[model samples]
Target: MLLRQLEYLVALARERHFARAAEACHVSQPALSEGLRKLEDELKVLLVRRGRAYEGLTPEGERIVRRAQRLLADRDALREEATALRTGLSGTLRIGSVPTASGAVSLLTDPFCAAHPLASVQLRTDLRAEEVLRRVRDFEIDAGITYTPDSTEGVRTHPLYEERYVLLTGASEEPAAHPNVTRPNATRPNATWAEAAELPLCLLEPGMQGRRTLDEVFTGLGLAPRPRVETDSVASLFAHVRTGRWASVVPYAWLHVFGVPPGMRALPLVGPVHGAPIVLVLADRRPGPVMARALLEVARRTDAATVLERLP
Candidate 1:
C-alpha cells in the first residue's frame, strides 16, 4: 500500500531472511513484520506464506515483488533526477557484465565516472547474458554488458564491440612453437582453429557463454579441443596458459589490457574468425533512469571495438 511496505517486500525477496530483510530496511523485525501485515491486509491477499521461519513468497507475492522492484526503482530515479537538476546525479550506478566482457567494462564506467563525480559505479562481472537481462528487468542493475542477446523485447541495446578470440600460449619455444606457427608476424599474427585444437588447452567451463562460442567454432571446423584445465575465472585461464603446458582461447580484450602476459604469445585465431558482438543493455522503461540514459549515451559515442585494430 505504501512505498515503505514495497521496500520491505523487495528487501525480503532479496535477502530471503526475515531478520536480514529487517536489517536491510533499517528497521526492527517487528516494524517490518507489521508493515508487511498492513500491506497484505490492504491488498486482501496473502503476500508471504510463513511458518515460524521465513517461507518463500506466494505466487501472488512473486508478481507483486516484481512490480514493487520497478516501482521502487522509478521512485528512486525520480528523486535522483530532481536532485540532478540542481546538484547533478548522486547514487550508485549499477552495471552487470559477462565475465569475458568484464575486462573491458572500464570502457563504459571510466567515462561515466569522469562525467558524474557525485555517482559511484557497481560493476557485477559474474553475470551470464540471461542473468544480466534478468537483473535489468528486475531493476537489480541499471545496465548490462553482454554478447548481443538473442531477444531484445523490453530492453534497449547499444553495440559496444565485436569480440574477437585469440589463442594465448606460452612463448617458451616460439620462433618455432609449432610446425605451423614458426613466428608470429606482428601484422598478421594468426593460428588456425585446427592449430588451436592441437594444443593442450585450458578453457572456461562449458556452461559459460564464451566457452560455448569457442565450442561452436571448433565444431564447425571438425575439430574438438580437449582442454587440460577448465575454470570459470579468466585469470585462471591466463595462469594455466602461462605454464607453457596449456594454451587458451580468450577474448583479445585480455591481450589489450595485459598485453601477452610475459613470455606468452597472443595470436588471432583465424582460418575461421568467430566474432561476437558485445553490447550494453538497458531496460526499455518509459522515462528510464537518468543514470542509465547518460550511460547509454556514453556507450553510443564510444568506439569500444577500436582496441581490436591495434592490440598486442
Candidate 2:
C-alpha cells in the first residue's frame, strides 16, 4: 500500500494505543484507524484484533509491522543516500548508548560533527546493551556505543575503547578508608574490589548495565556490594559520593571531562578483571544506511580511548 499507511502501522505497533499512535503520527484517531483499515483491506487480512480499547495485533499483523519497519527504514535510507551524494554527510545521526558508555559517547560524536559539519547528532544515552542492539537491528538508531561480547550475529561492531573501573570516594579520614593511597605517590592508585565492597556505597540500580558489570566483577571476587543508596542516574551516584557518606565504583572514563567530583578521589579498582571493551555496534544490513556506515567509519578512525583516558 502507501508508505503513509506503513508509517501508521509502525506507529501503532510502537505505541499500542490507538489515540497515542494517532498522536505520534500527528494525525487524528479516525485518520489513523482509517489508514490501517485500508491497509488491511488491500492486503486482504485481519491485521488487528480490536476490542473496547486498542487490542493487540494479529500474527499476520506482527509480521507486516516488521516489514513495515524495514520499508520505512529503506525509504529513509534512500533519501539520506540522495542527500549525501548531493552534499557531504547530512541529517541527524541517531545514536543509542549504554549508560556506562554515556559519558564517553561524546568522544565519538565530537569528532564526527567536526568532520561532517552538515551532519547533526541525536544522542540517547539511556539505553541498555540489548535495547541498543534491538534499535540498531530495527533501524531505530543509526549507531550505538556499548560493551559487547565477541560476536553478535546481525550487528557489526568496531571496538571504540576499553572502559576501566575506578572507586570514587570521599577524603580518606576514617580507619577503613581503603588505605589512603594518594594520587601523587601511587601513580595509578588502586583499591581492591574487596575494599570497595566494604564501603557504604551508592550504586546504579541492579537493572542498569554498569551496575551489572560491577556486580559480575564483585561476584567473581566473592564480594557483594550492599549499596546504601541505589540510583538510576550516574549523576546521582556522583552526588552521593560527593556527600562523603557513600562511595562508588565507576568507569574511569566518566572523570575524563569533569574529573572526579569535588572532595572525592578516583582509584582504579584492582584485581580479577580486565577492562570492558566498549564498541560501536550497528545493524549488519547489506548496503546499510549511509549515515550508519559513516558513524562506524568515525569509530574506526577515532581515538576515543586516548581522549577518554585523559582525566582532567
Candidate 3:
C-alpha cells in the first residue's frame, strides 16, 4: 500500500527472519510486522503464510515482491539520474559480463576510465545472458556485455562486435609425431580441427550459451568432442587447456584474455565457422551521467571484434 510497506516486505522476503529483516530495514520487529499486516490488508491478500517464525511468502506474495522490487529499484535509479545530472560524472557504474565477453570489458574500461577519471567502474564477470537481464531489470547492474541482444523488452542494446569461435590446444610436444598436422607451419604450428579434437578437451557446462553454440558447430561438422573436463567458468577451461592436457572451444576474443601461453595454439573453427553477434546491453531508462557517458564512449571507440583479424 505504501513505499515503506513494500520496502519492509522486500527485506522480509530476503532475510526470511523477522528480527533480521526488521534490523535490515532499520526498524523494530513489531514495526515491520505491523507494516506487512497493513500492506496485506490493503491488498486484500495473504501476502505471507503464517507459522511459528517468519515463513516464506505466499505464491501471490512472491509475484508481488518481484514486481515491487523492480519498481522500487527503477524509482531509485531515476532519482540517482537527476542527482547525477547536476553533479557530473562521478559515481559507480556496475557492469556484468558473460564469460565470452569478459575479454571485451577491457576494451571499454580503459577508454571509459580515461574519459571519466573520477568515476568508479565496477566490473563483474561470468554472468550468463539470463542472469545479466535479471540483474539489469533489478537495477543490480547498469549494463552488460554478452551475446547478441535476446529481445528483453525495456532494455536497450548496442552491438559490440561479432564473435567467431576458435579451437585451442596445448602446445604439441611432437608436432612431427602427428601426421594429421603439417610440419609446424609457423602460423598455428599448423594444426587442424581434426588434429586438435584428438586431444583431451575441456568445455563449458552444457547449459551455458557458449557451449550450446559450440556444440551446434561441432555437431554440424560431425565432430564429437568428448570433454575430459566440463566447467561453468571460462577461466577454468582456459587454465586446463593451457596445461596442454586438454583442448577447448573458445571465442577468438578470449585468445587475448587467456593469451597464447608458451605451448598453446589457437586454430580458427573452419568448416563453416560461425560468427555470433555480441552487444552491450543497458536498461532502457536513462542511466546516471557517469554510466551514460561511459556507455557512449564504449560504443564510440570499440570496434570490438573488428580487431580479431589479427588472430591466427
Candidate 4:
C-alpha cells in the first residue's frame, strides 16, 4: 500500500469522480485507476464500486478513507516536526475564524510570526463556529478562533477573551432623528438593550453565531430587534453604521480595533451585559504539528485582556 495509492483513494472519495480525482491528484485517469486496483489487490478488499460512471466508495473504502485522512495528517505532522528540529519552526499555520473573532486573531499570529521569522500564517475569517470546528477536526486548519459553548468534543480550547456587546450609533446624529432613544442625551454614553433595539439597525445575519448570541440576549430581555439591514460581513456593518443614520450592536472589540470608524460612537450595552468567551481551538491530538504548537505557545503568553482594557 503506497502512500500515493492512498492519496488517490482519498481524492476519489472527496471528488466522487474518477476523472476529477485523477485531475486533482495531477495524474492520468488510467494511472489513478491502476493504483487503486493495485491497492485493492494488496489489501484484499474491494474499495471502489465498479461502474461506467463514478459510483460511490464501498463501505470498506469509506473506512479506509477515514484512516487515510489521519495517516496523511500524521505524515505531515512528522515532516513538520523534522523540519522544526532541524531549523526552528517553519510552516504555514492555517487558521479559521468566526467573523466576530477576526479582530482578535492578529493578537496570536503577529507575535507567532515575529518569534518564528520563517513561519507563515494564513487566516480565513469567513467561517462560522461550526465550520471552524469542522475544519480543525478534518486537519484542514491548524487551529481556529471562535466562540465557546457550542460543543467542542474533539478539540482543545484556549480562552482568549470575552466578547462583550455594545451599541454603536452615529456620533453626529440630530436629536429628532434619534427618536428611538427616549433619553436622547449625548452625555449618556450607555444604552440599554431595549433602547438600542428601537433604532433602525444593521446587524449580522441570523445564521451567524454572533447574531444568534445577540438574538438569545434580545429574547431573554423580551426585546425583538427587527434590523433594517442584515449582513454577514462586519466590515459592511461598520460601513453602514458610518452613514450617520444607521446604528448597530456589535462586539466591543471591533470598535477597539477599528477605532469607532470616524463618525460612530460605541456605547456599552446595559440592562443585560452579556458576553461570550472567544477561544482558540485546536484538534485534541498529543504532540501536534510544530507550527500549531508554536502558535499555541504564543497564544498562551499573550496578554489579550490587558491589551483590550487599554484600547480606547
lDDT digits (tens) for residues 1-312 of candidate 3: 488999998888878899999999999999999999999999999999878997799999999898888777767666656666787566777899888778878888877777766678888888888888767765668888887755768677888878887677665655432344332244543345564455567889888778887777677777787776899887887788666556777888887676676776777766565788888887776543347546766777777666666654
lDDT of each: 0.86, 0.83, 0.75, 0.86
What stretches of model 2 exceed 4 Å from their correct place?
Answer: 149-151, 175-188
Q: In model 1, which runs have C-alpha deviations exceeding 4 angstroms?
A: 174-188
* Model 1 residue pairs with clashes: none
Q: Which candidate, 2 or 3, has the higher lDDT?
A: 2
Please state the error at residue 71 of candidate 2 in Å.
1.3
* Backbone clash count for every predicted candidate, in the order shown: 0, 0, 0, 0
Candidate 1 residue-wise lDDT, 1-312, digit = tens: 499999999999989999999999999999999999999998899999898999999999999998999889999889989989989987899999989989899888898999899999988998777899988888989999998888898788888888999988777655432345443344556888887887777899998898998899899889987876899888889888776767889998877567888878888889888899898999989779999988998887778788566775
* Deviation from native of the Cα of residue 9 in model 1, angstroms: 1.1
- How big is the positional error of residue 151 in model 3, measured in Å on the Cα after superposition? 3.5
Candidate 4, residues 229-259, lDDT tens digits: the string is 9999988888987777788888888865798
- Considering TM-score, which of the candidate structures 2 and 3 is the better prediction for this target? 2
How would you encode candidate 2's per-residue C-alpha lDDT over 191-281 as one tens digit per residue? 7888788887889989877788888888988988788689877778888777776788888888865586667888877785458888888
For each candidate, what TM-score against the reference? 0.91, 0.92, 0.81, 0.90
What TM-score should be assigned to candidate 3?
Answer: 0.81
